[model samples]
Target: MTHDPIPARLAALKTTSTPDLKSQWRDLFDTEAPPFNRRYLESRLAYRIQELVYGGLKPETVRRLERLGEELDGGDKRKRGIRADRDRPITGTRLLREWQGVEQIVTVTRDGFEWQGRPYKSLSAIARAITGTRWNGWVFFGLKNHRGRA
Candidate 1:
């Protein structure tokens, strides 16, 4: 004879009381029927096995669920809307920097060259201030220049 597991027994009890719980949840929302609340309850119940088997709550698991919640809560929709409003292609500009030292990213744009979070308003002005005719590229594509010869 096989013994029923504690979790299995608890789960059966929880399942049998779902309708009453759902009614209470719906009442809390001041609605005769709250589909969203019922869905939330279903999701919570689905994670019961993890909560029962694991001694402690997992931070990574919670973080992943939080990220999913953000996406489901219209975060991605807002980002897509913002991108659509911009209507400009993202520049293929790259950043050159060192991992250990403070480096300035210089972008040559229509307005001018921006360096270290400041706009120079002219490339000539930046060239005149830097002392060298050519500057080495340090960081490319978010990675350190391993060759170090740049």
Candidate 2:
């Protein structure tokens, strides 16, 4: 009888140590593991292992999924929009706002925001630093209106 190694590998994830899981993540993803919880790593690693063995979704399936997404959002990002993660801009986008006669530029990064050569976890933090007062970062950056319009 042929032995299936996939089952054993997956079952091992539950008992694997944090360091081991990270090592496995590096091996499977060819990069460092994200700073997420152990459950997130295990779930992603499980999916990646299965995907590597059985292959990922088909190209036609991918296209169909994309079409479905567009249908849900009216195919126009500016029209219906996909607010999957709040209203954060896409990574690599640069936001410009003039504050007190000086133009403030903030760049969107994969992890967070970058402003003035400093990395910030939230826009509110940057807004606080910029104004030295409590301000809604979204409104401060013009991402949202006073009435909460995106």
Candidate 3:
């Protein structure tokens, strides 16, 4: 029968020093040893050890977590809608807005949005920088609207 190894891993995590933790991390994760704090290593290694022994979360559990995340982030990002919107927009199709008496403009790029000749990660980042607060980029630029909340 398969036995649970969680208890043993937990015990080792509590006793291991920083250098020992690095070695364990390499053995477990098979990645380059990181230079992290002892507490950080302990917590991460503890999590990984349990993840290995007990296996990962269920698919339903992951979906529930994703939904909770979307709700918390105030986005109901439908995959179909996102794909359709992305495919429809051509590069250089200018998105324009006026905020606080200043005209704001952004150009759609093959990879991402561009503003003032600078490549931006998201339009929301530009919106936040322009407004000095969190404003949904899609709503700010009239690309999308809050359809009765998430």
Best candidate, TM-score-wise? 2
- Compute each candidate's TM-score over C-alphas: 0.23, 0.51, 0.43
User: What is the C-alpha lDDT profile of model 2 across 36-82, one tens digit per residue?
Assistant: 88999999999999999999999999999989978987788675553
lDDT of 3 by residue, 38-97 (tens): 888888888888888778898999999888868765666664255344333578899999
Candidates sorted by TM-score, best first:
2, 3, 1
Q: What pairs collide in candidate 2?
A: none
Task: Rank the models by lDDT, top first.
Answer: 2, 3, 1
Q: Where is model 2 poorest over a 10-residue stretch in terms of lDDT?
A: 77-86
Most lDDT-accurate candidate: 2
Q: How close is candidate 3 to the true structure, as a TM-score?
A: 0.43
Which candidate, 1 or 2, has the higher lDDT?
2
Give the whole-model CA lDDT for all candidates, comma-separated.
Answer: 0.50, 0.92, 0.81
